[model samples]
Target chain A: MLDSFYVAWRYLAFHKARTATLVACVTLLAALPLALQVLLEASERQLRARAEATPLLLGAKGSALDLVMNALYFADAMPAPISMAAQDQVDASALALPIPLYVRFQARGFPIVGTTLDYFDFRGLEIARGRPLAMLGEALVGAEVAARLGLTPGDGLLSSPETVFDLAGVYPLKLRVVGVLAPSRSPDDRAVFVDVKTAWVVEGLVHGHADLGRRADDSVIIEQTEGNTIASAKLAQYTEITEANIASFHFHGDPAGYPLNAVIVVAQDAKSGTLLRGRYLNGESPHQLVLPGAVIDGLLADVFRIKRVLDAVIGVVGLATLLALALVFTLSVRLRQREIHTLFRIGCSRFTIARLLGAEMAIIATASAGLCGAALTAVHASSDELVRRLFFG
Target chain B: MIRIEALEFSYPDASLKLRVKSFQIATGEKLALIGPSGSGKTTLLNLVAGILLPQRGRIQCQDVEVSSLGDRQRRDFRIRSIGFVFQDFQLIEYLHVLDNILHPYRITGALRLTPQVRERARTLAAQMGMGDKLHRPVDRLSHGEQQRVAICRALLPSPALVLADEATGNLDPCNKGLILDLLFASVADQGATLLAVTHDHDLLPRFDRVVDIAEGQSRS
Candidate 1:
């Protein structure tokens, strides 16, 4: 066998370009499916884990997929926002802990989420630096947001306006960066957090004033400050709220009508989750209660269906590559027929010829497999980033 | 130490038949085989080496019945006892000069490549003026150098018989004479028998006897 290997090594070495091309083809075929499977499995695990962590979600009667995506991933699904009254109702249920989520704004391409301190505690997010949301208009940035935006405590970010043309619908609010959360390795790390009321402020449901009628100097502020204070172009929007003016931040409209995109409910137990789902089961009700896990499972079922097709495609490609390898080896042997005959005349047996060809193939296959294994490991290691770019982006 | 009687061999799918009525060589005789292009000089050599079995004949080389051994046994006997120098000096192109010489030892267990054998191969290469070319790939060598490497390989195992089929065919006149000198000197020093096929008649006088295979006949 060793003698056969020595001869095999010589043949392959002499034909460097052919051997290299064959090995590269094998590596590509091996890595394609291995990388795909590793990334898909990692994304599935991440999605399932996030869904399982959030027990239930309450939202307007609409696409449950959209509601779950909005709540769990802050995906721009634009499911109709449920009223704050619904969130108050869940809070009053005493069956579960309610955390209101309102996400309709962006800052520097990152979603700005408006929720309460309970949101952080519920998600087990720890403040890596600075303090939590200490007051309205203050913000807590996720680790990735802080790192990517270079925002530290006391830094400020302006929300992206809903429309650059329609200044009446909502004015972009300026938020103070009060804290940065530790790495969560999830979608949460890519979001900005604030008290839900701050989101209302951005929506024109809330406002701040030294007074709308009088400027801080006690003079008529502007000529357009009569009908709607937030819509008034001359009604100076507070770009920065310091301690002196922070006390004046307050909501103008009926607070009960404020919008919440979805309410995440943490059940006291599985029984409480069942009872909550049961109470929201009235078919005529405009709200729907759902388990985030079931919703994600439905999403993954569709993904897995696509995966099956992908796997089949890979299987066919693998078979084709295997055929190509056999063809290459056959042609190689035919090309070396004269050499084979010479070996025979030199007293080498037929077994040695077979072993020579077999050893060359074994070496190429083993090396290709090793390269594929390394590629799979790299995909596994960077899968979190892949998921973010694929789904969240 | 070789004999052939009533030998009849023909290639598969060919009409030409090689029939040798009688032939014999002493244990250490240097015999030259001369013939035209279509003559069976190489065929006769192949038969003597047991590479091709005679359909109806008796070939005796030392103790082995060359015409009757099985396929595997014949191969073993060839590697252990007979060395062939092909007409084309068929050195494996992928191997270096040294490994080409050691190929028989690698391919079969009939001859163990002892350290002493390796040393002897180096000494033989040095004598053939190929000692410095041992590590060079055989394909990169000049025609004369390649022919010398082929002769070195044939003598590496110190076989009982050395068969040459136009062994010096690719060399110039000067290198041809030099190669012939090397071949004769090596065979004489090892006490090995030599049977060579040649188209060049100028060097025919060096052989102890010459066989003309015009119709597969002999004249000594």
Candidate 2:
């Protein structure tokens, strides 16, 4: 048997071109599915880990996938915004601690997340360089964002439009980079964190300007005026920080009108989570509450269904590959009929000849599988950035 | 030793049959079967090699009935006792010359070649002028060199009998002489019997016995 195997190895090695072609076909066939499986598994693991960290998500009623992508991954825009009043309502409840997230802009292609310091604490994100987002318009860059954008503390980044453009479009505000987070290997690593007020300001929900063309003394006097009413003729198009008109620059609409993208809730316990979900679904609350893990699971279930179809296709292709191999072997046997006859003439039994052929196939398949497996492992080990670039982009 | 008693065979669509009655070759003797084309010389060799079973009567190799054995047993028996060299120089083209010569041993699990057997193969190859070409692939060799490799393979395991079906049929005059000399010399070294089927009348005198197969009869 060993001798037969050696003979088979020699036969495959003798025709290096045919053997290499077959091996390459088999290797690619094997590697594609293995790589896809590994990537899907890794993405699911990361999503699940993120979901498990947050107990529940609160947002305006919309597609559950969209809500999850917005709240958990910060990858997409929130179609509707929940109110800060809703956050206050949730915070007043004994069931949960509402963490408001206001996201509506991008910085260098990474999402700008406007939330309080509790968001970082809840997600267990650590500061790698400088401090966390401390003041308005000041930001902490995620590790990936910092590395990719070459950002550091004391550097500044202009907020890109919600809908990015090919050319350098209008920049609403410049965010001062105050800190960089350590590599968390989480979604946070791809986001820029700022105060929710700053996010609202950047979204044009709030505006501030200096009163131009007024003498400095007059401007200071107008800024100190205490009335809500501003004389339309005297009010400059832009207002500055002064004791009088600074009050006029304050938010004019009802506080409820300032909407939040979403609120992440950390429940006191599992019981509170159930209660909180029940309160939101009670048909009275305008907002929708969801378990991020459950929503992500549902999304993954849909993805897995598609993966199943892909797997079926891969299975059929694999079968076809085997059939192709068989066809090649059959054609090979036919082409080598004279050689087989020669073996028989040289005192080789039919069984030995067959074993020799089988050994040749087994050797090629085993070596190809090994090579493909090694390639898959290497890809998997270095897949994080590759997958992010391919899919998240 | 080989014995054939009233052997009869025909192709599946044949309207006529080829027949052989009472043919035998003694141990250690070189016998030649000479005939015109379509005289059933190759068919007789196939029957003796157990590649085909006779439809009538029996073939006995060393007193064991060849036709009576099952397919597996017959395969083993052929591998252990009989060697064949085809006129086409049927050396497996993918194998090197040395590996082709060692093919029979690879099959029979009889890789143990005594120094004498190895020396005999090398000496026979040298006589055939193929000793320098052992490591080369058979496909790269000339038709004559391939024939010499086939002969060396046939004689590798020192089988009790070597069957050649028009072994030198495709060779040039000089190659034919070298192949015949090597064939006879190798068989003599192993003290193995030779049953060669050929159409070349000039080669007949080299054999210890000459049997002509024509019109389904052996005329000695």
Candidate 3:
């Protein structure tokens, strides 16, 4: 048998071009769907794990998909302002810890999440370089953001466009990169973190009037500076957070009257989460409470149904590839009739002839499988960037 | 000993029928079948080798009936008891010369190529003037050298019978004589029977016996 294998190998190597082309065809056909499956599975696992970690999400009335994407995945647009009254309702509930999240800005295409230090502790993020965001306008960059943007402590970054390109809107705010988070293999690796107050400041919620220069007279004469003029001008334009001025950095209303996008609520356990969900759905409550995991699971269930269909399609494609391989081998044997006859004349039995042919095919298949496996591992190693390009784009 | 009694065969698509009656050779005898093209010389050799069984009669080598054995048993019989040489010198093109010589033993699972067997192959190859061509692929050899290798392969196992189908049909005069002498010498050294099919009248006198197979009949 080993001798037959050697013979088969020699024959294949003698026809290097044909063998290589067949192996490459087989490898590509096997590798593409395998890689796609791995990526989808990895994304699903990441999303579900992140969702399960956060027990509940309290947000203004909107798409639950958007809410989960924002609070859990740090994606999509921030929800409408749930009133401070609504937040107070959830904060008063003894069953949960409300972590207010205000997201509106982007730094070099990464979402800027404004929340308290509890957000870091809850997400298990650690500062890998420099200090955490302790002051307004200070930011903690995710590991990927830091590495990609080459940002370190004290480096400054201006907020990117909130909309596609709202040039007429307020100028981008300059934020100081105060820290970089340690490498965490989660959604935190793609976000920029700051204090919720900084988010409000970035959004122009609370206005500050700095005395640019004091006049020499005892009675001070004040000229509205560029900073105040820009702030107040923006504040007067927005009657509400409409599509026109929702991304506006200036707010004309009282700063205390402003609303947050959503509040991430962590229940003590599964029982408390159920109790909170029931209370919010009682119709007496002003705002709605949702379990991030359950809502995301519902959303993913639809996606998984599509995935099953895709899997069936891939399964059919794989079977077709196998059939094509069998056809190639069968045709190859037919084409090599003279060669087979020659082998038989040289005292090779019919069984040896068949063994030689089988050994040749097995070697090619095994080699192609090995190459496909290595290619998958390389894709897995670089899946982070691939996923970001696919989902976060 | 090899014997074919009242053998009648035909190609699957042809109406031509081949008939051979009372063809026999004693053990260790070298006999050649001489005939023209379409005279059924090659077909008779194939039948005797159990590669193609006679449709109407029996081919007996030593004591085993070639047509009575099943497919697997026939394969074993061919590997253990008989060897073949073709006119085209049908050596496996991808194998080296030495591997081609050992091809018979691979099928039989018989570890026959001991030191003595290797020495015998080397000596026979040297006698046939192919000692330096052992590692060369068969396709690279000249027609005469390939025929010598085929002959060596046929005799490598020291089988009870060796059958050649126009084995030296393409060789030059000098190489042809050398090949015939080496083939008969190797069979004599092994005390094995030889049944050679040929159309060359010049080579007929060297064989122990000569039989003319025409229209499928063997006439001495």
Candidate 4:
């Protein structure tokens, strides 16, 4: 048997290109389904864990899936934003402790989650190093974000502007990284958490500029009306907030109408959760409250249906590839007929010849299996992040 | 020694028939059999080697009757007692020279490739002037060198009978004489009987005896 294997190895090694191509084909065939299974399993686990953690979501009447994805995963497509009044509504109901989330901005590809300290307590996020968000314009980054951006406590992260071509649009805010969250293995691990006021700052809703009252240059102040001074375009506005200018940053209009993508409501108990869901049921207001777990389950069902279609397509392709491989082996056998005849005439039995051929096939399959196994191991190792990227991208 | 009498053979749907009334080769004798195309010289060689079964014949190789043996027994006898050298050399192109020489040992469990057998194979290769070219692939070697490797493979088992079917038919005149010299010397050293089938009458003078075949019968 060892001799047979040696000869088989020699034959395969001699024809390196053919053997390599066959091995690559088989490895891809075997690894595709397995890698997909790993990623899907990870995505399911990730989606389910986060969804089950949050009791309910309050947002504008739209796709519940979109709301849940945006509110939970900080997905790229934002759901229709309800006012801060929605969070107020939930708070006023006395049924839940509403955790207002304004997840609408990004700082260098990481979502800037705007919420109060209650959001941190609800998500169980902890400071791994440095202090928590204590002052305005200060932000705490997730462990992954901190590591990826090479940021320490004092490092600065500039928010990515919404529209680069919009000249009057929001300027990129340079927020101070005050703290780094510990590794949570959740979407929070890659988020940039800040106060809801800072998110409004990134949206240009709130800002600070050089005080016209203290303007040393009178030429920049175009108008001086009662309790109001209209400034010219040359009046320097601060894109970054510091201790010197922090007091100047204030809202211009009613604070109740500030936009929030979704508010995560933590019910005081089961009855309170039910009461909150009932109050917002069927669009009682312009807002709708949803059971996030139910919404995620519905999304997973759709994902599984698509998975079934993908599985069927892969099955057909696998069958076709298998038939093609069979044809290749048959053709190879025919081409080697003369060699087979020579072996027989030299006193080798027909059974031995067949065994040699079988040995060759076994070697090829084993090599492909080894390569497939290695690829699956890598996918399994990185499946958590891969799932996050695929879902949240 | 090989003896054949009243031999008859034919393919199943073919009109070709091969018959050898009587033929004999003594031990250590270099006998050459000459015949025209379709005259059944190759078929006669196959019949003597027990590769083809004769319908009616007494084919004795050494102490055993080659024709009466079972299929498996004939194969064993052929591997153990007889060595074949073909016109085309028949060396596997992928195998290097030493591996081609020892390929017979690898293909069958009957022959154990012991360390001593390996040493003897090396020595045989050295005698064939292929000691330094043992690692060279058979496809890279010249035609004469390939035949030398084939002859080395044939003599590796130290068989009692060496059968050559137009062994030097593919070589140039200079290589033909050189290969013949080496083959005859190796057979003499092994004390093995040589039954070579050839169409080259020029090389017949070197054989101890020559037999001519016409149609299906032998004429010595």
Which candidate number has the best DockQ? 4
Cα lDDT for residue A105, candidate 2: 83
Residue-wise C-alpha lDDT for candidate 1, range B1-220, written one tens digit per residue: 9988898888787766888888888889999999888678888888888888888889999877888999999998888788888868888999999998888888877788789888988998999999898899988998888888888888888889999999888889998898899899999998999999999899898889888888555555
Local accuracy of candidate 3 as per-residue lDDT tens digits, B132-218: 988898889988889988888887777899888888888999888888888888888889998888888898888888887763334
Position A381, candidate 2: lDDT: 87
- The TM-score between candidate 1 and the true structure equals 0.88
Q: Please count the clashing residue pairs in each candidate, in the order shown.
A: 0, 11, 1, 0
Better of 2 and 3 by lDDT: 2
lDDT of 3 by residue, A260-280 (tens): 778888887778878888888
Which runs of model 2 end up more than 4 angstroms from their true locations? A14-43, A83-85, A92-95, A146-169, A172-178, A198-259, A268-286, A308-328, A375-393, B1-30, B53-77, B110-127, B188-192, B205-209, B215-220
As for lDDT, the candidate ahead, 2 or 4, is 4
Residue pairs of candidate 3 with colliding backbone atoms: B19-B216
DockQ per candidate: 0.67, 0.46, 0.34, 0.80
Q: Rank the candidates by DockQ, best first.
A: 4, 1, 2, 3
- lDDT for model 4, please: 0.90
In model 3, chain B matches the true chain B with a TM-score of: 0.89
Q: For residues B27-131, could you state the per-residue lDDT of candidate 4 as single tens digits? A: 999989887888878888888888988889799988899999887888888888889999999999888999999999999988999999999999999999999
Worst 10 residues of 4 chain B by lDDT: B211-220
Model 3: how far is A20 from its true place, Å? 4.4
Q: Which segments of model 1 are wrong by more than 4 Å?
A: A76-78, A105-110, A143-180, A199-241, A248-255, A269-272, A278-284, B12-14, B114-118, B172-174, B215-220
Question: What value does the lDDT take at residue B90 in candidate 2?
Answer: 74
Superposed model 4: Cα runs more than 4 Å off? B215-220
